[model samples]
Target: MDRHDQVLEVWREFIATGKISNEKILSPAIMNSWKRSRECGVDPYQKKVPVILKEHKLKNLLERNKDLIEICRPFIDNLYSFFRGTGFVAALADVDGYVIDVTGDKEVLEMTSRGSFVTGALWSEDVAGTNMIPIVLRENKPCQLRSTEHYCWSQHRMSGVGAPISNPAGQMLGVLVIFGPYEKANPHTLGMVVAATHAINNYFHVRRMLTESQISNKFQKTVIESIPEALIAVSNEGYIALANENARKRLSLPENITGKQIRDVIEPGNGNFLSIISSKNNIMDMEVQIIQDRKPKHYLLTCNPILDAEDNPTGKIIILIEIVRARTLVNRMIGAQAKFSFKDVAGNHPRALETISLAKRAARTLSNVLLLGESGTGKNIFAQAIHNESNRAKGPFVSINCAAIPRELIASELFGYSEGAFTGSKRGGNQGKFELSDGGTLCLDEIGEMPLDLQTTLLSVIEDKSIVRIGGREVVPVDVRIIATTNKNLKEEVKKGNFREDLYYRLNVFTIEMVPLREMKSDIALLARYFADKMSARFGDELIRIDDDVISILTNHSWPGNVRELQNVIERSISVSLTNVIAVDDLPPEIRKKPAAIERDVSLKAMERQLLLELMQSKLSKTEIARKLNVTRCTLYRKLKVYGIPYQ
Candidate 1:
């Protein structure tokens, strides 16, 4: 239908509903805004419909310039609604010319279309010519034209008025033209077009702001992706919505993590930690370690809420920064403060207790004592027990592992060193263990491995009760007790020409030897319980116990590596065992290969007697057997009588 016919059709539909009890229908004018709704849908201006029948056409021209037809629809709807009786919006060419958006009164609109009166028809001096809409648009103002004003004698039968809309920034939209059967000029009607354009200008201002907001969101996403930190954005419900590339890489997420629950991405424990974070609580600077694929990693996760314009939290922002390293745990043992007294050293075995008692007795003197033991045979413990009982217990107990130091530097390590002794050395002179340990005890661990040159220097220091700096000539007097320990036999090293026999004799003030863990089978369960409780407290885990089968397995092992190996096994068991009770399955593979528990129970003396008898049966001379036993002939006979082995 043409513009006039469609107006009549909507009129019939509205009248047919007949409930018509609403307020008197509004008169046709620009502010009705009927055309506004269709801008998002179809276009009707330069394409769909006419202009005088529309409102806000000028506003559409400036901001909606890309889709003029669609933009004019709503403005046209507004104008058609202004007057109830048949009406149409028309776009005029120049004063003598065509029409653009025309509606209402079917027969009237079609005649207007066929008559070359709108849209493509010229509405300015350069075209079909002399129309108010184009001329006013050219002049940047509002104007009116009646049928008589038409410059062409043949086109004098139409009348319309048009106004141009301006933006907040004061730029022209397009010309809005309204027309109907030629009527006497109503100046008030023209005022309505001007008023409608102002409304349109306000709409453009609002749209510009919305467009700016979209641009800002784009910039925010760019910034998040570019920053170094892994940023995770979550909703109030704890669901992931945005995770940047860094976060995805750090967390090792395979797919887009958006919409995943927070529980699924971080460590299992970290989910609980996040709950606490959302609760607004924190354990600041606490080290949180995460182990992934057997490699330990650390991260510091800090959380805060995302706020809205209202200053209320809408969600949370979790920022993850990788921790380079937590501080490496220092070797914390009882020796640090000499807290172990003889009372804590348990050994019901007669020889063991006798050795402990002898150590206590020896602690009271200024003797240079040596301890022999395999690693983790409680050698350090015995050393601490002696230091605590000693008269010099109030002083620091300095410990240095001679074998652990490089061969080239063991001498300087034990003696004082002057400034500039070597590159990367301390700026000023450094006091060695001997000087630092004055009035205290100095423990030389793995002492048998000390270089021959360092041994000579140490031998002189002990004999003269003084030490010289590595780079200085002056000798310094010092007072200290020495506790040297090693797993190697000094006699074997002497025979091998690797140790000084004279120095060993000079330092053999008192000797204590620790039994290896396997030989002390009676104490395995006791020590296991002790370590379990202590480790539980240290790691904040539940205390674990060894099953009867595991204890049985422990007793059967050869334990050639001694107590140090025992500790390692127990630590590995604790790490791999998920239950509170450790079973034999948790033991190392070597332990599984050992003989039955009862098969390994022979006493040390009994085993020694058996070995000696076997050697005697070979008719080996007393000296040869004694050498094999690491003792002299006299000691061997005394041991043979003690074991009641008659050597006929």
Candidate 2:
């Protein structure tokens, strides 16, 4: 029988007997769908196609499947172009089998719209009964439906081909359908729909990967930028691939240096950063120098290799830090920090209290400070205390002894010299104390001992706030607070032509006289106890106690070396003392003999009086009497005159 006659016979048999005896007259796919439609209680004589969603509901469904609809739009448009004259309408439906979008011949769309076969129409087997969209969605496969295959009579003249669109994981997302008249239907039409849906799925997979890559790159860039240290990433080929904001600023690099060779940017000389990329081994804390504005600055470099999935080196990451910052870190680790505040000065003697009050006031100003005191008085301690209490407390406190350095090299030591400025000069030159102490305090200990000529240069530096290196012409400005300590009387030296008068006056702007230890005798016991406690920690023992007799001896002896001498005596006593309590016997020989020395001075005075009295009685001449007394005539006459005896 002809195809129309066969379709008619199957329809009639299924309706009359509630089953189809002519199942062999149709394709297995179509027969199976027809049976499913019948089991779903769909009638072959039904006239109306079900509307799944209208207006607002349809808009909401389209919005929910927006990604699927967008991915299939372009592919569906191209498919429609190939079948433009074939009366086909390309439609996309959600996995629920509701038509979300349709595009095709205007006349064919108009006919489908009248039968509720357009957008928002339900085409599921249970709703519209046996259509390509519903059947493809149900079976999760491609399908072809001929005219008589549709269970509803209203769709008897229509043919549709559809395929379920799925993601990379093979989970169905939606269906792509192409519908036209039954006369134009072919197996190839279904193949075309299946191929188009595959292309759309590929687009979805690629787009998802691109999105994830973008998110990952953005997160990486943010992390790199947030780091405080300079960071650079170099490719295996030695070209810079990425640099953070800190790296760019530190290297003085342009906004974008990607793909530029590392040597062109950093000019690695001693660091050998490129070797790390090849060796794939990490190198840390390597000191490297880079020249900027014709002067070299030091930086510590750390390089770590970036490896690929195969465990082979792909690139290297570089971290850079200025040597100054590294030095600060080292200083902290070694306890070179300025830990003493004004509270640590430890004394209530009026002179000591007054000195502390003056120091605390000086700590608030930026003027130069001149600490005048005898040796061993706590000048260095006061210097550090002033620095810690100042606004620049966080900065470094660099101290250099003027008397310690040789006169010949003191000039270069105070003001750095340039490269090749002198023999034995560092390759990149060196930063002087002034530069090193920038934003901090520089204590010039024993400032009186500074040479006469260097004082003139120092005066100029103080006036100008800048220094020219001994061998170089570059003028480096420094922001350092000068705290000069001197044991000698600068005024006397200036008068004696041994010091520059102008420099002396300039440094004496804010003079703080550090009280001598002997004058503040009341503080001796307190300071002794303090030093004993400190030495105990170093000696790894319990705190040593000072006996009252030892304190009395310490107070009685002349501390010519000031507080420093007391500390030394205390430390010596602790070392020799067999017990934890320091006694008078543990005192140094000089301190132990002080009382005898005082008694001996009184006896010697009485002996001299008797000897001079006897010499006058013998009637010796002034010269003879002076010679007998082992003194000069002037000294002997002065002694006789002060004693109220005859000088003649």
Candidate 3:
């Protein structure tokens, strides 16, 4: 007999005798499926599929598998076109074996409908018996079941080929099936289904990859924009690729700066962008300038090259920090910030208070201030207090001692020098006190001591509110408030042609005369206790008590070094005093003197000897000692001889 008749005969025997007597007539996969179907209690005589799903449940199943059905729609139509005139039905089934979609010739569709082989019908082996859909879904591979190979009698006259539609990982998502009359059974049908499944899987993979790429790009953009510093990305070809908000604002660039040339947007202070791209080297804290309103704005720039797998430059990433902000951080790192305010200037004397009050008023304005005082009279203290109390209190307080820096180097120290400006100038140039003190205060200590030539530059910078570095032509703008302090009377120095008369008058607009300790004797006791308390806190000890005698002796002395000398004495006393109470001996030897009772009882000749001893032990020169003693050099020599004192 024919193969179909032989398969039918075997099926009948297996159903009636519950065993395959002619197992050789059946393939291993078909025979195994037959055994499983029988174990599931499937009726071999059933006329139709027994597991048709309800309408609502089938609708829900189709909704869940919408993507699969949509992706497979064109492929299914194309596959069916090869057998359009033939009696074939193409259908898609979910992993659960429920048919979700179907297309077929009208006549074959009608015949399959009668067997419950249409959409929404379950076609698994347990319910429909040894069909291609269930076999392929279970095996996760393609299969063809023809004629009596089907375990159920209703499906014996039909044949179907099915292949699994799976993800890239090879896990089955569903099956694609083509059913035809028993005469049309062919192994080639399985090949067609598998080819379509592959096409669907490729499309699915591309769609997933595109989605993930979009997500990653968005995340990177968010991170770049969140940074506080200006950020930019540029292609190696010099085109701007990306710029964060801060970058656009800082560079004064348009909102849509992408595709613009890098040179058109930025001006490098060192070299051209092309050279930088060709070098492919990282740049750190390189100075650069961007022009806005015909004036250049400075920034500290950092650049890192983006490299490909071969380590070749693909692009670059850049970060920009405004020069003012950068200098502020540098000032903090170098201890250039002010630490005193108006309240730290200790004194209740009217002259002292008046000077402080005038300084406060000067702090409120933008004019230059000049502090006149003797050495150690707290002129620098007033400068610091004015800086902390000014509008630029939060900014840097850079100070340079005009008398301390050598005359040869003071120009570069005050106005800075360009790279290679001098034999030993630094690379990338240097920021002078003016640039470093931008938006802050600059205390030019001992201004009268500045060289005559440099004083002209200072006057010009003060008047123009800008400066040019040595050997550099660019005029950098500065907003520094100058507080020039000097012990030498600037007026006298100007009369002697030792200082620039024009510079003196320019800085003398708001002058404060720091009161000396000798002139403010009434405040000595108060200032001593203040220093004592401050020292005690610093040394982690109880405040030292200043005895009345100690204060009296300090009050009587002429403090040529002024308030600074008093502070040093107080600190010294606190350091050496065995007890918390400071006494007359705690005073420096030069400051000590006999009391009123001793002065009255002592002989004039003996007192002169004691006075000479004190002056000799101090740092005073012979001329200064003679002046202090109100004696001519000739008479002072005679006195030193009578007292048996040696002279240099």
- Which structure among the candidates has the greatest TM-score? 3
Candidate 1's C-alpha runs over 4 A off are: 1-339, 422-425, 593-648
Relative to the true structure, candidate 1 reaches a TM of 0.40
Give the worst 10-residue stretch by lDDT in candidate 3: 269-278
- Expressed as tens digits, the lDDT of each residue in 194-245 for candidate 1 is 7666566667777778878898999999999997767888878888989889
Per-residue lDDT tens digits of candidate 2, residues 224-336?
99987899988878899999999888877778689998777764453444454346567677655666554577677788888899988888888988867865665456454
| TM-score, one value per model | 0.40, 0.50, 0.56
TM-score of model 3 (CA atoms): 0.56
Error of 3 at 387 (Å): 2.4
Please estimate how well model 2 matches the true structure, expressed as its whole-model Cα lDDT: 0.80
Total backbone collisions, model 2: 0
Q: Candidate 2: where are CA atoms >4 Å away?
A: 1-229, 233-239, 249-257, 260-336, 537-540, 593-648
Which candidate would rank higher by lDDT, 1 or 2? 2
